[model samples]
Target: MRFTEHEMTVAVDTVARRLHAATRPPWRRGDAVAAYDGLERMKKWRLKVTAGEVVLPVLTALPERPTVGAKPEFTEAELTAAAQTAGRDVMEHRKPGAWDAMPAKRRDRVLATAVELTRVAVDGMPVRQDPDALIVPDHL
Candidate 1:
């Protein structure tokens, strides 16, 4: 979720300072506090799309099911983990709504670019290759 100018400023002012104080090894108390605070205020965030033509709801309600799918190939645990890592990426094609508008192409372009960027960013993260590791989430 994206924050407005006012919201961004307020978050930086209120939570950023608390985060600095909790800096410690193994556990960042301040960071945890800031995360908790952000969760408390998650509702205030809005969905950000540059096109702004399509009106999508800014806030999301709690999902009905913790895991969406437990059928076919993916299990409940896999679905839960996937959902936790990547929240609803549901996007509608604006072309269906647009009536021969020039901006339709632009909207599709923006959506495509956003998806590509997300893919690149996710791939760019460093993968842990601990040879001694036996479990997927041993630390957890």
Candidate 2:
């Protein structure tokens, strides 16, 4: 859906916060590193969007889903459907025709990113202890 720059920023920030919280005490080192990298990229995109360098700051590549040893709570199809519903809910709140105005590629990219992010968030292991104790190295 087409969004104002401010709206997009808010949406990005919302998703970023969700991801950061979910990945704070990452299930694995690699997951933490990937989450950090994705957050960094999102930060850069936010800047570019604010500067008008990019109309939509959708990620070109989807975030990698974490591998869980235990049985997943949701199936892949369920997650995909949930993500699409979430995306649609967000779009439905916007002005009519705005979503349709966005190009198909942009819409698909946005949905893909959303779905990947949701999957990553949901797949993260539950942390019982304080997440702040674990420090992910910046270099990673």
Candidate 3:
């Protein structure tokens, strides 16, 4: 769940590329623009996460810094809110019928990964930066 700055950067880039590819050709111009804007917002969020100004509940510590500086502890309500926000964002972007199409086992694994990522992000724990360590399945 915890990811390095490099990992986050890769993720942002991958998402951007994927979104662009998805919105190409027959896709409406407005849809592409909206996707671009959303990606821009995500980039800003990634910057905040990198600067230690905002702690993302999906990432823990960076490789170089095993321990984080004095970040304010998030309350239970704050943690819940953050997790909920993450879930909603993911759900909003998911392809229609995709969730229902997944096998139950796969769905459970995905949910577990989400929980782990959220926990590490909230705890500010250190994590590796392997680009290939993405949780997304190839079939998806």
Candidate 4:
């Protein structure tokens, strides 16, 4: 799908936020790196397909930007620790930048694209009505 620069930028942020929220303790060494790689690929795809270059946004404008503040309430380590405490499966956190697999910023975009894509069926049907086809494969 075709995505504009602003869309990509906002998307990356969303993924990063969710990733941060989903962090787990004792993360792997290169998770961040892996996530970033995923984001880059997403950006390329958006640029290439021009999915709905002039349509999606008109359908739904993103919500108001969050308020800026001082330093974040939780660092990566803190979030990881929290995840562990909450019994969340931090190992499966799949945003681009949450770990070394990706930079925090780009991860958001990647996630947005992923979620956006998975919402659709392969046959061009809305996924909410037919989600079986959007299933993702497990990683090694």
Q: Top TM-score: which candidate number?
A: 2
On TM-score, who's better, 2 or 4?
A: 2
Superposition TM-score, candidate 3 onto the true structure: 0.30
TM-score of 4: 0.21
lDDT of 1 by residue, 1-140 (tens): 33234433433333333323333255644465455445433322321222111112211111222222221122334433333223223332434434334375665554444333333222232332333455577677
**Candidate 4 lDDT tens digits, 1-140:** 33335544444443443343345345545475355445566654553344343223311332232223221122334333332322212223445333446565665554444334322211132112222345567982
* Residue 95 error, candidate 4, Å: 22
Q: Can you tell me which runs of candidate 1 are displaced by over 4 Å?
A: 1-89, 92-103, 128-140
User: Largest lDDT belongs to which candidate?
Assistant: 2
Candidate 1 has a TM-score of 0.22
**Stronger candidate by TM-score (1 vs 3):** 3
lDDT of 2 by residue, 1-140 (tens): 22234444444544555555554774556554456466667674654343221122222122233333342355556655555565555466666566677788988887676666544433442422333467679999
Instruction: Give the residue spans of candidate 3 off by over 4 A.
Output: 1-92, 125-140
Residue range with the least summed lDDT across 10 consecutive positions in model 4: 121-130
User: Which of candidates 3 and 4 reaches a greater lDDT?
Assistant: 3
What is the alpha-carbon lDDT of model 1 when measured against the actual structure? Answer: 0.33
* Cα lDDT computed for each candidate against the true fold: 0.33, 0.48, 0.46, 0.36
